[model samples]
Target: MPRWIDTWMPGSGPEAPGGGYPGERLGLPAQGVSAVAGFGRRLAALTVDWLLGYGIAALFLGADVGTSPFAVLGVWFLLTAVPVAVFGSSAGMTALGIRVASVGSEPVVGVPRAVLRTALIALLVPPLVRDSDGRGWHDRAARTVVVRTRP
Candidate 1:
């Protein structure tokens, strides 16, 4: 009945030999709202973005694509950087109800920042992040954060 009930268990006194539980102090909640529409939504968005990029690449490279890595980079650059500059959200993030914004600012990332972020993402492994806040390395690299938009 005390406002500050120290422990949940029946006999968890201050001097209890064993603590109540190992992680009882970490009162972190389930993060339901964020998680509710996370991986699935993000994955779907990435798929949409990839399709868009692939289409663009197809147009640029044509049927008989050459073997220049620069060309491939150029295509990917156009696919990602252009869209991020024009639209706050990439095709994938748009579909997934997320937008990229400056970490400490209300403004969206500019073309150069977007290019860096896109480059990291295109590198593939760098974008795969598993932080508690659900941000990828690319997000961190660009000083940007991805937020789930309300629609």
Candidate 2:
């Protein structure tokens, strides 16, 4: 029996050959997360998005910006969503100190996934779309998770 396995697995010896808790590799934290924490972070992210969206809309309403209302909305969405997903933080996320990261072991993320995630997020309903993991469609589509920033 491997000593490390014994330490974490407890009752199961190394020769017991698995089937104890059934998740996580070793010392790493369990992949499963709390729904409440995720929801809170998402709410903060949404607040940031709201501010940006309304701010853009207001700007478009003004005579100074030549962009059409729809164009301004589009720009607002792009500006807000793209940077947030790829970098794991946007103006809102930055303010809230939360970041979006891939679910996989690697931290590298791409634009397409980010775009899809952002689009779903804009729907404003799908983020509430609960799955087995309690993640919304946006989170699932992006294959990303939101994490709080370190101080």
Candidate 3:
């Protein structure tokens, strides 16, 4: 793939007609390590993240965060962005056996992209919309994808 094309579209591409699996266009396996993560795993990972974020929010927000809400979201942003920038996986993603990786880069997304990705996820609309490859708009916008680390 050309660097310019990758620059423009990140993980977008055409694959063989019978590829028959998500992530095929991005040169990922159909199963096991580095395969595109399934929606159920992604949702479960997010549930864990949200619970953890709420726990941390309770520490500072003193019950008002349940009303304010954005504080919880803010904590979630930090929880996702910082670890994703440094380790390629948030705590929940790690626990769930997934990691976020840039489609055009080798291992991890940088801080700016991680922040953007987390912000889009916070919107609650982008993550619900997925492309053929199972990448949500948040992943697309960040030029990143979530892939399984284990089978």
Candidate 4:
């Protein structure tokens, strides 16, 4: 009988060759800048973006973000999608030293992919469902990945 660890864990059996860390399969560096962004960094970037969205909605739309969910979401979507499309990262992502990039040969994620990714992220559940490599469903659907910009 095989050991439980061998049965459940990937790359654990003799036939399985461990590729490397989480994002290594995607050709990302194992550590330092350009590595996959971890959960804590991703969460921090999200928090920053949310706060910015709330602020924009409250100030420009003159809506109490606490009471106006749609306004905040709209602002959030704009903040996330537009910047990621053009710059590869939002203000929050930039501040947190992370960026979204295509999983393919391209270095930048185009507007369509950014929009789709943002939409799925807005649905909430998609972003919560992460693959073994830590890529959310939104990312997989868009063929994009978030990576650290600095060591």
Candidate 5:
């Protein structure tokens, strides 16, 4: 039935403005620094971090990395958590001109939140599930957001 289909499928109602653009609900700027980072930027940052982690594991463990995924995971966790805890950005995020920030005024995310966020990100699914505001589950759980650093 048309009614049943409409009810079953969300976003199928009459066309209407859903409010403002992404991040506007969070009071983020439309552009420039403090604006929400887009998917491409986030993906690029993740790619860089993953490559760096892989390289580290390969360098330290050599061929052993091919046999143990945990090694790569451990390195990736460290690569993602440490810098985010101390500097609010990893090497990749810094290079991409983006940084993770708490919803509040905290300069750094601290160890606990950073660790939790990294762990969720490592699960892969959490990072792929985004909300209407474009925030991933990992970020939402950690109460952090990735924002642009430069205009």
Candidate 6:
């Protein structure tokens, strides 16, 4: 009801002019392939990836999440970094039909950038902080954006 309400209430208040979908600035579609990935999907993908990392840690690294957090985190780091560097998507992201792309002109998220992104992700705070475009701080720092692969 108050004019200040819009500042704090997400997705509420009177419609602000020029408000467009996320990824509009990147020249992506509004609802189809290449559109900015929604938080739900991105979260789901992260869940899947985390579970996978946990499993890998348990089986190969002999690490339990409760007893050996660093092992699980290390696994997650590799799981996120290598594939993203090579394919533009991690295993979970691929399964969920989303991929990380460049906000800049770069064609792919290279190893160094992917490692940096994963490192920030390991810190866990960066991903929780999203921008107006719905990109996490890690993505912004790496000049990458997550986009949908399917409509």
CA RMSD per model (angstroms) = 11.5, 10.1, 3.3, 6.1, 6.1, 6.2
lDDT of 4 by residue, 72-91 (tens): 99999999999999999999
Of 4 and 6, the candidate ahead on TM-score is 4
Q: Write down the lDDT that model 4 would get.
A: 0.84
- In model 2, the runs with Cα more than 4 Å from the true position are 1-37, 63-72, 132-134
Tens-digit lDDT track of model 6 for 2-83: 7754432334434435978776766788888898999999999989999998998889656345698888888888998999
TM-score of 2: 0.63
What lDDT does candidate 4 reach at residue 142?
86
Write the residue-wise lDDT of candidate 3 on 1-151 in tens digits: 5565544342454544764789887889889999999999999989999889999999998968779688888888889889999899999999999999889956669999999888988889889888778888889888888999998
The runs of at least 3 residues in candidate 3 whose Cα sits more than 4 Å from the true structure, single-residue gaps closed, are 1-19
Clashes of each: 1, 1, 0, 0, 0, 0
lDDT of 1 by residue, 1-151 (tens): 5334323212222432343322122221234322223556666777787766566766777864445556655665676687786676877777677767665544668888888888888787765653434546676567665555753
Tell me the spans in candidate 1 whose CA falls farther than 4 Å from its real position.
Answer: 1-37, 65-73
lDDT of each candidate versus the true structure: 0.60, 0.60, 0.86, 0.84, 0.85, 0.83
Order the candidates by lDDT, highest first.
Answer: 3, 5, 4, 6, 2, 1
Query: What stretches of model 6 exceed 4 Å from their correct place?
Result: 1-17, 61-65
Estimated TM-score per prediction? Answer: 0.64, 0.63, 0.86, 0.85, 0.86, 0.84
Count residue pairs with overlapping backbones in model 6. Answer: 0
Q: Which residue pairs overlap in candidate 4's backbone? A: none
- Ranked by lDDT, the better of candidates 1 and 4 is 4
Q: Which wins on lDDT, candidate 5 or candidate 6?
A: 5
